[model samples]
Target: MSSLEKLTVDKRTLKRIIRELKKWKAPATVLLSLYIPPGRPISDVASLLRTEYSITDNIKLKRTRDAVQRALSSAMDRLSRMQKVPPNGLVLFCGEDMETHDFICLMFSPPEPVPVFFYRTDKWFHTEFLEEMVEHEETFGLVIVERDQATIGLLKGSRIQVLEELEGYVPGKHHKGGQSQRRFDRQIEQFVKGFYKEVAEAMNKHFLPLIEKNALKAIIVGGPGYAKQDFLEEAKEFLDYRIRQKIASELIDVAYQGPAGLRELSIKASDIIAKNKYAELVKAIEEFKRHLVRDDGLAVYGDKMVRQALEMGALKFIILDEDREDAEALAEEAKKYGTEVYFLSDGVPEAEWIKKTFKGLVGVLRFKIA
Candidate 1:
């Protein structure tokens, strides 16, 4: 058995999956969303997949049943032999045909647990939940700086997208005589000034637009020492006050300054990253709570209430705890009712509060649901 690193589904991944779903044309398809709890045995999920496959034989749709079964079997075999299932959970899609063994197997782990279930259908794959996951993602700009170099990137959920790298000249202070050293220092000061100017320009060009557009929530700056501080000071005049205010964290211990630096910065600023990622979800939960307190009938909670709102075509939006096993079904129903869905990640404090208070399901209604 081979273990694979579990990856969180990001915007790029979700977009690619959506493209694949749009292009997928098959006689039968099997879509399995399995929840792999942390520290739980993989055999449990594998056995469940096997049992679910066994029941697919009774599907009266003769033309597609066999193909669906083959796809399900392939999915089961793949799941059973895995040494590690994603700690978050896995969603696997398999397309099979009896005539040609050209099967399409696609698997990705969500950033949070998705509802665990299996569905064999000839229609297009269910992806509302994934779309919701992508919607809740908050993008942040990442900057890692050194005296002579800097790296800029975008962080959306668990994915790090490097955008640009900058390098400049900063002369060393090691001249022989005092006069010579003074001259050398003057030249170095000039170079550092020019370097900071270029850095400010890069920041304005690459990051400011996203901040202005509200696509990016915050910026995390990190570096080895005073370099980061110096760069921030120089760039401050160029960046809008609003954008500068979005600077959530500054790290002084990052030793690298390129792509590796961006990665290292991500690790060093994990707390800020998590906070940015869940900030929007937390805001949405807050709004839901406001509605609840006002008794405006604009919000509803609990599994039963949310499902009822969905059935009545009254849901404007649905917020679900990703850990809830029934979220997938409810999200699918919400989609049919033309309601948008958002998954509340457990990493956020408000999400845990919602789970404890509302049984992890909530809805904003288009109108009173009584």
Candidate 2:
């Protein structure tokens, strides 16, 4: 299957599955993880498992042999039921937790095609491949440029990473008189121009590949004073046209110029980062807040109120912080009522607000529910 294919499974569900699978453990390497890519013949996989099952007999310990064989049998049984591989692909995790003696056979038609055929026996289910499929692949380039210092970063998913920090020596303003002052001014201009080129080089190095991959959605630039504008103006000559064109139109004004400034730029560029996943989440929270401030019956929060709203079929949309104890259960319940569900990460301030003020779950009702 093509890597460009959209994931067939919901991201939340995939994440939940990964979390659940990660918790299961075995004392020995009895856990089995099987990955069958799209277009592979199920019969061939069944045969392979049968062969593996026969090979398990060579195990020295009877207990280990029994566990491995049972897992292989379970995997074969699952394949026997499937007529063919799913469009995206098939993933099966069959294992016996030796410590608990509890068995699990989980199968998934992943959100994306399984990259290759793989099988493993280990203490835990191999979920790295599935985890990759759920990762937020698209990213936004963040650039904070000032005269003396600049920071370049990437906003990927809900996290921000500082890629490079550059410092420049553009000596304090010229205080001398006549020829000396003019020379100093000329030297300062050269230093500023050189600094801008260095920033451009970093931007090109970091953002160009993302652009080529079509993963970079846009670039946001910010800084204090006219330095940002000056950098943008001079960037046309030193920066790649592709990178220049991707720069957001509304350059932000920020007080700081390093990691802190990158974050400030992110918060300020909400409008420009419209396509960003975190921005979408923040927007949803803001909408919920608006409803709450107006005292509209449409907004409901806290465990009791949100649960009641879900039960009464009044919920139109809901946002739950994934860190909540019952978040997964609430998400499942919300889905049954046809309510749209959004999962928020813990670090986002808006998400934290919902967690602290609203008990980590909030819903908008389709109609006021008394």
Candidate 3:
């Protein structure tokens, strides 16, 4: 929900693909090969648009292994030139090792890049056939600002998070409405202060259940008016440190509910965020640099810090900017170990919505924070 998504294919395209995949009622077994080729092909590199091709024919998934390999080789040859590979370069395997079921052929060509579904890879989603499987309920979140509101779309691997809206009380609502020169008595002013404080206290009470359930991940502060400001001042003592940090940006919009304001907030959530692996990690390090007040080298940069995080268990979590480029190694490394990851971009309606829903993006830490 916090950036890391692109609506590349329109609804029509998606509908068409869905229809086609439905028509593809094969045995659910597909051809698969790791064709090594005749001697590792003495070429520098080849631009065979890499992808997982799911070809279905009137043939058996297992039997077509050889023919599929040969066809792939042919396709590769037509696209790029190569030297010598092995006589029987590729090997055949079965089961989970072969993710392609009902496969006619599958290859990891780098040329044709199909966005593989890696659930939670960016935000929330895994690359799997959702057709036969029941679709899980998405973690929908909402954020309300004074002027606007927003709603978040659950992505690949998003957990069931909470969406909360805290409304602060403004005291003058119950008083006389006309142009009566009204001056508040000391008792009345005291009552107003108590009223505002009570409102804040009530909000805390409301969130107690959610916190107990741990259904929230982040909280976004937004609205057209000063509700967020008033709430922050009143609830400062009860606020989480990470969430306090997440309150840096203020919304200039107006809305009655968080979901209403989420739409406008998303527009401001797009900048300086990345979704791609190394780029996302690197961008976080860069932003992390700004938060370093003492700069005692505890706050550092480059692959060095990342490597340390990966090794010394310093990476409690990784923040990715939504505008990231390609990098597999860093993502893979994170998965190899147990580390939390998030992707965020500015100017997206869901960005603020996500923070509001989850309470803010802080995770279990591997090391102490400064």
**Best candidate (score: lDDT):** 2
Q: Candidate 3 — which residues are off by over 4 angstroms?
A: 1-162, 165-219, 267-280, 283-370
TM-score of each: 0.50, 0.50, 0.34
Q: Among all windows of ten consecutive residues in candidate 2, which has the lowest summed lDDT?
A: 1-10
Query: What TM value does model 1 have?
Result: 0.50
Q: lDDT tens digits, residues 45-109, model 1?
A: 67766787788778888656766776677778777666766666677777754456556777777
lDDT of 2 by residue, 262-359 (tens): 88988888777754556657777788889999997888888889888889989888998776656656766776777767778665678667778777
In angstroms, what RMSD does candidate 3 have relative to the true structure?
Answer: 17.6
Q: State the C-alpha lDDT per candidate.
A: 0.71, 0.83, 0.37
- Give one digit per residue, the lDDT tens place, for model 3 in 1-370: 2111221232223333335334332222322223233344434223321332233233465544444444444445433432433232322111121334332222222111222212110111122332211221112222443311222221112222234443433344336534442444444445544544544444345444443443333344455567556545755665455435433354344453433345444444323112232354445545444445445434433444555666666665554332233223354455456655555545444455434543333223355544
Count of steric clashes across candidates, in order:
0, 2, 92
C-alpha RMSD of each candidate structure in angstroms: 14.3, 10.7, 17.6
Distance from true location, Cα of 54 in model 3, Å: 29
